[model samples]
Target: MTDVRVVNEQAEQLVGAAETLFAAGVMARSGHANLSARLDGERFLLTPGFVRGLRPGQLATVSLDGRVLEGELSSVSAEIISMHSAIYRARPQVGAVIHTHSPAATAFALAHRPLPCRTEPMLRFGQAEDVPVVPWGPRGSDVSVRGISDVLERRPTTAAVLLANHGLLVFGPDSAATAHLVVAIEESAEAEIAAAAIGGAVDFPEGAVEAVRASIARVSA
Candidate 1:
């Protein structure tokens, strides 16, 4: 069993990240999503089903295999538990995961459209030029898990994806990075949508994608 105080701190951290999302306009209902961070090799801390007004003591500690190692009777969101578990299992390097329902981004997802990578923000911060929309699947089902898993596997460089008619999913090396990516995605989607209202979003100059990718590689190296 996880220590009470230790888990409490983790819960606070999750809430802090949620606050960031809330500020960025990614989420408001709180019931719309969840966040988690790896606790150890075998487990992670997940927010209770919804956290709009949840205290720090309300989070859950879940094992890698999907067991609720620690939490109350109504802790985990049954609809999204598998989605979170699959991501953690598939991406060992990811220390944090954020599920969001940012309106601009979710609008694209709802329309089954992809997020354009034309914006400088996306080119500089994201690995993929376009954020793929996952194939539609019933929420919380194995099909949903597989749809997300497959896209992440195929586009290992991208940190975020739109869940068809669902919302957005983003993971990163830590909470800060994940949160930044979440905000970036929201902004990018907003930009794309706004530009569409006038004419259409213009693509980057030829070879821009390669140049950005090269710069990122050099910086990381």
Candidate 2:
């Protein structure tokens, strides 16, 4: 497809995902989380800083290096430019990235706890073990980028991460799927809290994990 067509499609999808997330109450009224889609090998589309009431045309078009190729500079998530760029650079296969400060998951991050991958939704669409929690970093800093980059580099299959005292970041092959993952991570965190309130949740056995992974691989393939 033409560049214009691709960007428009990406813009539409990103807008839809953002609105869905906001409506689900995962995204805040504040400009906390943002979504991005790979427009090409060298460029991508990022959500506007304020997404709750945004239009598709308002999203920013940026290079893989975080250069604003199009859109108002004010619309970009300048703070997370490095975070998004680093993910694309580290994982060429990743087509979209999402950052959210969903309460449940962020609660886990605040406590420096790994989100257990016990629930079916998390096991199937999220990670196999506990989701890693990266060290804390001030907003829009190199430290934040590095914290996230380390996990993406070490665990290439990682679908989500809990940024210490920050929030959650998730990516996938498409904007819609990645957005779904953001929600799934929050759900897993909520489940963990509920389970802990009782006694503790049982983790999947090593063999059970392998079976589920194998099943997911076949279905995805």
Candidate 3:
């Protein structure tokens, strides 16, 4: 079991992230979302149910293999254990995963189209390619998990994906980065759709993403 202090810290981060999403106006109307953060190699801390009004005590500690190690796992939260686990297994560097029915991003998922990188934030956040959409499957089913796993395996550089007819899923090194990604992608989607009224959103040139990366590297260096 991970230490109680560590679990609480991670849970706090999840709570803050959920609030941030809500504040950004990207969270689903139902306020239902699942968030998790890696506690170590074997375990993670997860929100047990709805993300709105989430608190540290409402979290559960689950092993990477999907065992609920501490706290409580609601049936709803339990159902998605495998879904979150699939990402951790496929990408060892990812420390947190968040799933939400954010409107604009979910619009792309509903349309079965990838969210193209049409804004600088999309490129700044490591989204060099269009965010892929995983075909719809029963939520938390092996088929659904497999589709997510397949996309993660195939798109190693993408930080997020659209779950067809469902919602958006974002993962990163921590809850903060993942939350920021959800906002960035959702805002970009909203902007692109609005642009369609006059003229369609224009995509970055072929080397734009690479150029941004190089510039960031140089500044950091």
Candidate 4:
């Protein structure tokens, strides 16, 4: 059986994190994002739908088969839960997923251009490449989930991906790591835009990129 206590604790934590982001303006008031945490092999927890400014105790525990066991007052974010579920099913290493529509990142998404790795944070995250925009899938459609999964399958090391004309989805080993990636992606997007305004930015040298990757690997190990 799955550990109910652990699932509850993780769900609460994710809710708190979501609230913190919303309060800080990382998530918009119109319910622009959602967060989820894996709960063993068969279950996960996700934020509820239309619930602006999530808080602890507001998250719902959901089975891999999409059954909701808690927090019935709110519905799951349609595309959000599916997207997170897809990733968790495909990548057992992923413990948490965060989806947000932070302004700068969303702007890039709308433009259908990948944010260039013109800064240190971008390179440090995953050897900054053009954030590929997955083709538009109808909102709330399974197509978005499939598109995201396809991209992630091809680029397994990626911590973040931009959904074409949508927003950003970031994943990591756990909630804290996923949250860090969210911040990194937003900062990278801001930096890239700022650099573009100041003239074109330069890509990090191969040596620098290698050094950063090595350092990350050592620290992670």
Full-model lDDT, candidate 2: 0.81
Segments in model 2 whose C-alpha atoms lie over 4 Å from true places:
29-31, 213-221
Q: Estimate each model's TM-score.
A: 0.85, 0.90, 0.94, 0.86
State the weakest 10-residue window (summed lDDT) of model 4. 72-81
Write the residue-wise lDDT of candidate 3 on 1-221 in tens digits.
56878777788888889989999999878888899999888888888668778888888888878799878987878999999998888889999999999898999999999998889887777576789999999999999999998998899888898999999999999998899888999999999889989889887878887889899999999
CA lDDT, every prediction? 0.78, 0.81, 0.88, 0.74
Per-residue lDDT for 147-210 in model 4, tens only? 8889878877677778888888777788866776676678777877888789867777768777
Clashing pairs in 1: none
* Candidate 2 local lDDT, 1-221, one digit each (tens): 23788888988989888877877677754757778998878888887656777688777778867688778656236767778888888888888999988888999999998888888777776566678888998866888888788887788788888889988888888888888887778888888898988998887766887788788889889
In candidate 4, which residue ranges exceed 4 Å CA deviation?
A: 19-25, 29-31, 50-53, 73-76, 125-129, 214-221
Q: Of the candidates shown, which would achieve the greatest lDDT relative to the real structure?
A: 3
lDDT of 1 by residue, 1-221 (tens): 55767666666777787777777776645457778888767788877656566566667777877788777535237567778777888888888888888888899999999887877666665535688899989877889889988988898777788999889888887777687788888898888889989998888889987888788799999
Q: Which pairs in model 2 have colliding backbones?
A: none
Let me know the TM-score candidate 2 reaches against the reference structure: 0.90
| Model 1 TM-score, 2 decimals | 0.85
